[model samples]
Target: METSLETVALFSLKLAYEEEGLSPILRDDLVMGDYQKDVFELLVRRGDVETIQFKLNQCLGLAMDALGGAEKPLGRELRKLSADFGEVRSMEQLNQPLLALKGYLKDIL
Candidate 1:
């Protein structure tokens, strides 16, 4: 699949919102960031589980780097997401939530 940064970023933000149910205050930056759309489009084009997870991990890494690498609560959530995706790498191992996410993205386009 062709990876587009915009898709990946959007997917990451959406996953963050869905997983953590972030309040408006916490979501403002993600929603308004100039790079968000491009990054998300990149990830969507990548389209493989491992690749998507890797892109998310990279995003979290960048966030941590910008924040002086502090151990924030969001880091834990990203770790969990990484692990969950790692476990269900194959389509055969996919669970309801992941499947739902895939379906949701399909509908988005």
Candidate 2:
């Protein structure tokens, strides 16, 4: 779960910030401070699904705009996946949607 969360953050940041001829933001980059694996670990440890969803939503929302907004096909698909994330009601129910969202974001990048 932590890994998936970190992947979502990393890919979202890449979608929003990466550019040609520039160094990409790696896992240990300072920009990942708030969305790091350990942060997700802590949230998971406490069963804080709401906070986890909030954090992921933050990145996904930026990613939506980065993809050219909801009118665009990719952005529309991203919006649908993000809505799935919002439907999670428990930590146990989170894995499937999180993985789906992560996979989509990674593929698009």
Candidate 3:
């Protein structure tokens, strides 16, 4: 299917919040930095995939950190998500792994 950065961003947001239950507290503590939120808004408003990917990686790292020291599998999953997100250069290129990551998150969350 045809997609834009906003499509990906919205999907990521929904998957993260709705599916993964990324509450305000989790966001305040782990993700949702000002820069990351702005980058996400840029993606939605301007379709700037490049800028948001970096921010996404940052949030992923923070989320990983919030998982604490013992959950190796969750940490690995977030790492894989970060790696896969880093590879997205175009809308077409993003679909497979984004969907895969959603499925993975389904199992995890």
Candidate 4:
């Protein structure tokens, strides 16, 4: 089985790509924090508001340890994402999607 950490990382990458389309440079920038400020802009334009919010929570939870140590703007975006989506009434509503992602991550990892 894939670990939750790996699953979340892969999902983040996939979601990022889906929102922004394929761009190696952009992907590299995202991974390196070079494009942190614009990460959500594409998602917003694509009408992926929910996925963006979900991704923010996933990234935050996955990197909480590292985020505490790194001073990257991604951390701030994640915080904003959490605030935007944190009010959802049922986390269980996301369980199915997250589970599917977990399976995919497990397979790849």
Which candidate number would show the highest TM-score if scored against the true structure? 2
Residues 60-106 of candidate 2 have per-residue lDDT tens digits of 88888899999999999999989998999999999999999889988
List lDDT for all candidates, in order: 0.46, 0.92, 0.52, 0.45
The better-scoring model by lDDT among 3 and 4 is: 3
TM-score of each: 0.36, 0.97, 0.52, 0.30
Candidate 2 residue runs with Cα over 4 Å from true position = none
Runs with alpha carbons beyond 4 Å of true place in candidate 3: 1-41, 69-71
List, residue by residue over 1-109, the lDDT tens digit for candidate 4. Answer: 1233234554455544434445533334546352243554464446564655465565546543344422556545544444434554444343444454445333432
RMSD of 3: 6.3
Tens digit per residue, CA lDDT, model 3, 1-109:
2232233333344444553434433333332344444445556456566766665555455556655422687767767766887888875565677566555544554
lDDT of 1 by residue, 1-109 (tens): 2223334344545543444444532224645364354554554545455665565456545544433343655445444544565565643453443444334333432
True-structure lDDT of candidate 1 = 0.46
**lDDT at 67, model 2:** 96
Give the C-alpha miss distance for residue 37 in model 2, angstroms: 0.4
Show the colliding residue pairs in model 2.
none
The local lDDT score (0 to 100) that residue 33 gets in candidate 1 is: 67
Alpha carbon lDDT at 67, candidate 3: 53
